[model samples]
Target: MYRIPFDRVNWTTSSFLIGTALIALFGLPVYLYHYGANWFLVALFFFYLIATMMSITVGYHRLFSHLAFKAKLPVRVFTLIFGACAFENACLDWASDHRRHHKHVDHDGDPYDISKGFMWAHIGWLMFKLNPEPPMDNVNDLRKDKWVMWQYRYVHWIGLVVGLIIPSALGYAWNAYHGLDPWIGALGGFLIPGIARIVVAQHCTFFINSLCHTVGRQPYSTSHSARDSAVMAFLTFGEGYHNYHHEFQHDYRNGVKAWQWDPSKWTIWTLSKLGLADSLRRVPDSKILLAEMREARRKAELHLEEIRQQQQPGQCQRASDKVHELVEKLAANYHELENAIAERVQLSREALNRWQNETRGIMREISRIQLLTPA
Candidate 1:
């Protein structure tokens, strides 16, 4: 068992306790009361959820942490401001810790390791003072930007004022105009949408650390505990593809497939098209496929080895041959898909548009076939 060090006790903080209490007290009550059970509130919540999730995935994770894409000044600023409303933390702090987490995943240094426990990974790490001071070494890239620095400096205050106060004020104004009870509007708008949103949003973002690591499939790399879960990805704006992310951290899109529910990737793509973002980086398809192929081969070889240890020499050889045959077939299929994608990329706009639909259908069929095959 891993022993808890005495120094680790310093990790706990009152902010964590207070934050948890506030979330439970305010969020649960409002959520139970309004619960957005109706179509209107449900629609509103969905929009809020998408916006907030994108702020974390696209803005904080991809933009600030990995520098996977560049956003226009206004877009960057807007994301930063709205992201603060998620109540995760300043972009610099969150990004720094995230970089560190990727650098030291599943090790002693990883800020949130699910092996420690589900709750610890979800929120306990945030409650403690893991480091006496905010991590500065991992955040040099963020320090160069003045806007980032400003947000980092006053994010908490900004969240309270803009996320909470502004909403409450607006609620009051609406109530006054409509001749309704301002308190009801304040509770519905500010308390429900503002504080409750923060609580839920924070947990959804944190789930990637806890649930993603513990309860998903590791198809890409088994070196770490990170895994992929479609359900978690939906909650986290496509961040639940933890295995692929651990394998290829620099890719702007987490859920690379079009059908994957990655609002973060969609948001960045939309922004890029509208000239609000640029320099969107992605891992080359060749490299990604190569990694996947290598991992699959490794897994097949391991299974073959296990069988060899248990079976006769002749049987072992036959199993090994089967594994090799499967690897070769899969590799060839992947290469064909890659070439098709490349060809599509070279087509004219009209031709490309026409080919994309057909290509997507073919790709979907290929994925279905691949999924049916044993990993």
Candidate 2:
């Protein structure tokens, strides 16, 4: 690998990340032959993955970046600790970069601009310094958070302690209890959940940047690279609904539907029920309906535009009657499309009304219960 003079490759970041890749690639095969993995180590792999991942999805990304919902101090602390263990960056830095990504998207100032290519967006942006100067001006809101700021100030030390040291210690302890040699246990901890887990987890985040944008449907917004993808949601733990996230950035839910794979949304809601989170943000159904209608309209218009281009004056000059027939058919189809669009909007409006009525009934019931109970 060629090193550039101006590239602000933070050696701390590059060394650990690159070292992990090397370990996962070369070290894993050697280690597996010698000690082999046990059920306990396998369990650690999943446990740490979920714990650290939620710290980013629920903590660093949504809670800090978008402020989709308010969390209790304990929740924040939990997320902060696990989030640091993920080793992406400081909470402030991650949130600041995310806010900029949303604000600029594929245009200038987007740190991971997909326009540069999928590889670039996925991981290259981190390896090389694209913006040169870090943008502190964007995240003024997060600055007010004492915990977030403190995390940013000591993120490097935090990463070292929480990310590597703790996992390694836990691995050694687990192995020691099983009567295995201390060195083998230490090696297992350092490699399995420590390095391998980080490698896999980091790529999941990268997939959101690369695959989520490249592969999904943009039912919510075609103006950006973001798209809605269920496969991605499965892999990235519900961050795959990029289209909705880009369109409704403030909404606490990524997978808004009942069946959508959004564990993050579930976590936030569960915490809210426990009084650990509150003011969960949700976009109104009416707004979502309107966006759907707009998208349908855009699709129809695009189809019409393609037809218009194909039927240029010179292309149809030899077949006047055919052109007239096509025109009549198109006119009818256009009218039908218009009517369909209207009907879709009407159906959505009715559904929204029904939902609202149901919500009101629930609220009233809750209010009655509250009134009956003494504070």
Candidate 3:
């Protein structure tokens, strides 16, 4: 069991996290029971939810942390404002920690290393301060941006004003305009959209650190604890594709598939169309396919070895021969495919297409080979 280092407790952070969560848990139901939810309150909750959640996923994680894309000033300012409202921290700090997490995943230097424990990755890291605070040297590029520096200087105040005050103000004003008791709306706003929304957004982001690492499939890479979860993607605005993100950190799209539900990716694409974002980085499909094929090949080799170990020499000779045949072919095709992708820049379009098709065929063969192996 992990022991709390009371001496090193981050009182402010702990208080805020615990306080907001308690209120959201108990206070929200009570408020609903008394005043009941109105369309204005529901709209307010969703509005804050989308704005703040997108700010963290699209703005903080992708744009700022990975430099996946560049955005215009208005976009930057808007994210900074609402991102502050999410109350995670300034972009520089959040990005610095995130970069470090990727660099030192599941290791000593990772801030929220899941290897430490699920709770630690989720929120314990924040409530209990590390003896030595992480240095800020990693974010020199962000420091050069005046807007980021400005937000860093006053993140708490910005959050209070925009995240809480504005929502309450809007609720009160709307009720007043409708000739209702404005105080009720103001209270509802502060509790539901203001406080409750913060808790929801925060936990969703935290889920990326905890649940994403814990309960998902690592299809892209098993080098780290990161995994992909469609459920988490829905909750985290598409950040649930953790394995892909870890393997291809600089790619702007987390859910790389055409049918994947990555609202953050879509939002960035939309911003680019509106001329608000540009220079979106993407991993080459060939490279992504290569990663998948390599992992599959590794698994197949293990399965072959396991089969050999389970059976006596010359037993199941046909199965052994078939496995050897598939494995050899896969390796040869993998080598040729690697060369093709590496020389893709020099290859004509038709030639590249042929190589891609060959790679896809090898992928299908790998899948079928898995079924041939004994359960």
Best by lDDT: 3
lDDT tens per residue, model 3, 282-327: 9987787677767766766776776566766445455556676777
Per-candidate TM-scores read 0.79, 0.82, 0.93
How accurate locally, in lDDT, is each candidate?
A: 0.72, 0.78, 0.88
Model 2 steric clash total: 1
Lowest-sum lDDT 10-residue window in model 3: 366-375
Top TM-score hit: 3
> Clashing residue pairs, candidate 3?
none
Residue runs of model 1 more than 4 Å from their true location after superposition: 1-47, 130-135, 312-321, 324-375
Model 1 TM-score on a 0 to 1 scale: 0.79
Per-residue lDDT tens digits for candidate 1, residues 1-375, read 966555665443446446656865866576557533333334444556566767888888999999988999987788788888787889998898899889889877788867778888988787655556544698897899999999999998977886777666765666677787766656555655566666678888889999999988876789999998899898887899888888889888888766877778888899999999999889765556546655655665565456445655334254445545555555565566467566754434464344344434433433332211122
| Native-to-model Cα distance after best TM-score fit, residue 44 in candidate 2, in Å | 1.2
Against the true structure, candidate 3 reaches a TM-score of: 0.93
Query: All predictions: root-mean-square deviation over Cα?
Result: 6.2, 12.4, 2.6
